[model samples]
Target: MRVVKAPDVRRSEILAAANQLFQTQGYSRTSVDQIVNKVRIAKGTFYHYFKSKEQILDALADQLVLDMAYHSEQIANHTQLNAIEKIVTIISEQNRLQSEQQNVVDSMHLPDNRQLHERINIKIVLTFGPILATVIEQGNQQGLFDVKDPLSTIQFILAGSLFLFGEGVFNWPPEQAQARIQSMIILIERTFGAQPGSMIIALNQCLNEEKR
Candidate 1:
């Protein structure tokens, strides 16, 4: 007897196959036929789940944001770590993922990919802001942060950190990037009323670990 897969399960299988192909073959080189062939699904089935290759890319971007949020939430939920530690862990994880996926990052630097890159960034901030805000709210309760609005504060931080320091934007020198990072830390600390230099220490520690 053969079994039937649920719609959502089938959709995820398609996404999984597409993600693997996109990572291995490059997104622009991968096609609908390849994705369906990998999954042994009909072309029509792929269209049922996604209208086009671009739509699959959009879904992949959404998955990336959700995966990041899920990991950040896990750090935020850790009982032993304070709010600052959770934030640091989240940042560190993000940096680690970025390093691991440098190919994906570099693809976004292509001139033709600018629109898709911008769309992905918007999706990331929309999905990630609330998760970060939860951490900020916890900080407020613990008296580590004194911001009146966690959501808005997170949005502002993400705008600068995501767009300004993000790849393919300013193309800053190493020294300039470091300076901007330091300034961002200071801005975040001051805006939320966190202790001076604490965020800097955390960021430095994360960067140091990335070297090893």
Candidate 2:
């Protein structure tokens, strides 16, 4: 009988190594040979787990979107915060996640895997819908926000916040990324028909001193 180890554990280890290597070098520069060598796995074993380097990078993107979902869920659980406060929380959380993903992307050429990138982008956008729905429901119930279509509104906000990252259209200074995100949050809040002053104040309080 063969002893069995958890597939996910081994896969997670492989992905961790890939992330590290891909960051230091780059995605395009990272070959499967190096990854298996670094992971101390045989070439056959590597194929057993992943079909190609693109698959691995796709896995990386999927992991990030899952992480974003996890973090946003955590923020949603902070019921102590009000609806507006939750918007701020959501903004900071997504921006924080984007920065980390960008660092990983910087070390890799993920755009070459355009399909995977688009899939992961959809994953992130889909993950955000629930939280926004909750906020929209709460705000409308409280008469603090007006919305005709919660789903469409959520989609718009998600697109506005993350469109640039998905398309690689915008890049901001490291010191200013948070600020730019906050600015987008302000735009989203206003577009959703929330009072900018209270929402902005709430968002500013959520950001670190440096970001504010």
Predicted structure 2: lDDT: 0.70
In model 1, pairs of residues that clash are none
TM-scores for all candidates: the values are: 0.83, 0.77
lDDT of each residue in 3-122, candidate 1, tens digit only: 468999999999889878878878779889999899998898889889988777767766666777788878878889878998899989877776665446556656777887888788
lDDT of 1: 0.79
lDDT of model 1 at position 132: 84
lDDT of 2 at 184: 66
List model 2 lDDT by residue over 59-122, tens digit each: 8877777777788777767768777766677777766775766646543334566666556657
Candidate 1 accuracy as TM-score: 0.83
Superposed Cα deviation of residue 130, candidate 1 (Å): 2.7
Q: How far is candidate 2 from the true structure (C-alpha RMSD, Å)?
A: 4.1
lDDT of 2 at 62: 72
Error of 2 at 82 (Å): 0.8
Clashes of each: 0, 2
What local lDDT score does residue 56 receive in model 2, on the 0 to 100 scale? Answer: 82
